[model samples]
Target: MKGRCDKKAHLTGYKAGDKLWVTDPTAAAGETLQWTKQPVPEYRADHPSSPPFLRYGHTATEYAGAAYIFGGRNEASVCNRLYRYDPYVDKWSRIAHGGMIPNARDGHAATRHGHCLYVHGGYDNDMEEFSRDLFRYDFREGVWHACALCDRWEGMHRDFHALSTVGDKLYLFGGKSDELEPYYSNRPVYDNHLYVYDPAAERWDRREAKGEAPGGRRSHSAFVIDGKLYTFGGLNCLAGEHYNTVHRYDPAANRWRLLRPHGRPPPVRRRAVACVHNGKAYIFGGTSPLIGSPMPAKSPAEEEDEPPLVDHSDLHVLEILHMAWAACGLPVPRHDGLETRPLLPRPTVGRRRPPARPKVRREVDHLRRSQSIFVRQRYGAQRPPLSDRHQ
Candidate 1:
């Protein structure tokens, strides 16, 4: 959150939609925001039928007034196409690489500083490999450059992990070397270590995170505010479990703390993305299983198909000012900061609300409320927006 403007900011977001949207934290509470869907340019004038590039597992970062998106996949394969979206112009232009382009990949992470766009670790299909190389996309020069890796570890090649940037440092949290496949008897293994790369110092440090660290996970999301790192919701494939917890790490203190708040909480989910606007963390879409997975469902009717795939489109805001969670909707025109009341929570279009939960004991009754919905003292809110179960 250091070096961040204290006013008039928005969280840039992209997901199931092939376009972009942003959350203006300055808007009045619960008032729908006015967002425009931009036009994606045609690669060729004659190719009018060509589908626009829509992606997940891709990385988009704000740099020098434009949003730079790189490396992701569609239904059939991975992609290496780099794009720039200039909000001022409401247009998206593909930036062709002059020389060699890095391998096309998805599930990678990227961040920007100054004019440099840093991309690292994603699953590359062309080589049938996971990339260990760090690539820099220099907008000023319109060129692609690779960083010199030092004492590389196998972990550097992982995808689906949480990669975050703060200052000159790039930090990677828990990830697995493998993704889930139907017949792989061995479940995915997650890394418990933390890797920090100081591009300025030209250094990489792999060290065990101290204190009570969360278990290894993948497809999780993280963001930095005021120099402290905050991580949220992820999947533990080995156990087929998803986490709904929030953890905060203070590097200066080298410790972790779990945040349990009295507010509407989102449902357990994974692979969702997040951005920090104002001083709050806004989390968006990610995939989750309708039910815990490992073995198929016991019901023969349900066993005929795979577990329901949950891709959420709902918007959620976690006030960094406080740790409380609440559901958000489309943005409205600029206004003063949202007040505590005057908001109506709703998931994105066509999302079926999560099934009801079984009753809990009296002692922990306060924790089950939806975080997106504004309830009483003890609350809970909406979870990720639902997606196609078949895809």
Candidate 2:
């Protein structure tokens, strides 16, 4: 939590290569103020046809007053386009092309290490074609370079893995080969092998861990906060099991530990993406099986009871500095310093009410209570909005 600030003097937006540790904004505001005064902020969504730049399986980072988004699928095709979004100008400009750049890919992993962008293995087209090619893009030099191709102990191409940057090394884990058909398997196959790539030495080496590691998963999310890699929620090997569990990896110890929380992680989903800002992990839109996937339903009753799912447009802030979670709806505004206003919370059923019924009129009081209950049941509860689900 060192080097973190939550006061008005330090309420800046998130940027890559910025401070990895920061104070929890909601927590720093005090528990009552966080929950009652500003439960969750509501941010309006952009138009549906905004742009194809920040589509599926891509990565984005903020730096130098601009947001850099690159490498994802556009429509049904793979894209290698690099785009820079200038908040000052409120516009997006194409900086690079997708022509023969990298394979048309999804399920790939990308992270900003130092001043360069590092991208690794993902599903090339279908889940069958996995890519192990590693590449890096340097904005300062305006160049791209191939780093390494991933391989298992038996020399097979692996994909659908989790990659993260911890300290100076890039780490990869829980991947399966292209030859492995995930659809037919009862559970996701576990590689249990850890691969580390060091950019300084340009060498690849395997690291061994001493504890129980997570099982093989595809489309899982990993982000570095306060020098630790926090991984959460993705598809597990089980037929219908989507992970809501959280795990933290300590690079120095080369170990994994489970994170316990009060409730399930939002809802079980996959292909989700996360980025760190001010020591908080902000998660945005991604593909979910509820929308597109090939799997049989377990039961009609279960399906009937399932809550409606959508491509999330909301942003979730995870405070790595204090180990907290808050649901946010507003787009990360392009403001910094003392000019930013902490977002106001979305209204809950408990807070808003109609005119109070007089105590002398017992019938009116009963009617009011019944009305409130009916409204609450019908609407359930209002959570924050998903303002940046992307076009």
Candidate 3:
């Protein structure tokens, strides 16, 4: 008749710590939030189902009780393959279809409405250009349909943007564009504009939002909860800026309000995957430069050997209704004095400390000596002196 207990276990049914962590709206103020990592399913080597290759910038949309993953780039090349994951069976199956298949691309945005998946703009590496076409996959019919690029949608080409479905419409927001003016030399230009797509009428409308917007960013994650759209951490490449801030947009008011949620936030990053399940926003893997650490200009060999940014494998959850953040069993990194500091102190884009003058002079002299030796070896006595070469 006694209840069971485990001393080392974080969850048990008998004690206060035994209860499962929940984001209940009516929970007491002192309720603790915890994250539990789910177990990965295993299968035999000969099994028919297998996982997709490691990738990023792909679209994963939950539709009809399964997750459908679309095109993304891997180390070798971009792909246009589609795979479906069934959580109930813990299996993955590649889907084969016949229709106007999309090009192999990455950085595209996708969303599900009803039973179909809508995929939009991405960069096609093979074509060496950004895609502006839209494609739709009808789950019920098992066919892919390419939507016509109407004249009105001509200037809406973009990649690394967020797309979310609200009611019967789709809302697209901030992303980088090659057509936009660069904020600094040799850097990407990002946009802060909002666009709405009406599938019923096949029309696109650009909405001019009021209030202080989160200006010009790309690779940010966004999701909709209770009719409001919320966006999180993105990078402003042109300004050499990264963000960990959160912003909420109310369609009814046509306004954006920056939200300062309670608890420690994830470090500044972009290209993170975010989704809403049971009123909580879960954010996963992304990339960011080291905090307060900027690299100086280096030689081409050094630049090739060292990476400028770091990739993250941590997960963080945000309680939407409560406006609080929780981590998944990992210690949240602290950004000391970040909230009180201005962003102007950060490194400017396309700028870095030059190498010491003496080092440069030495490199130049060495290059000249090497060239003079090569000329003497090739031409022998016919070669001119170093001082007479310029004359």
lDDT of each: 0.58, 0.50, 0.60
Pairing residues by index, what is the TM-score of model 2? 0.60
Candidate 2 lDDT score at position 264: 24
lDDT by residue for model 1 (108-183), tens = 7777756777787776544434556678777788888877673455545566776677667887787655332111
Candidate 2 — which residues are off by over 4 angstroms?
1-54, 62-65, 97-100, 125-128, 152-160, 180-192, 237-239, 262-265, 285-310, 313-315, 327-391
**Model 1 clashing-pair count:** 30
Clashing residue pairs for model 3? 12-18
The Cα error of candidate 1 at residue 342, in Å, is: 22
Query: What TM-score, computed on C-alpha atoms, does each candidate reach?
Result: 0.72, 0.60, 0.68
**Pairwise TM-score winner, candidates 1 and 3:** 1
Point out the higher-scoring one by lDDT: 1 or 2: 1
Clashes of 3: 1
lDDT of 3: 0.60
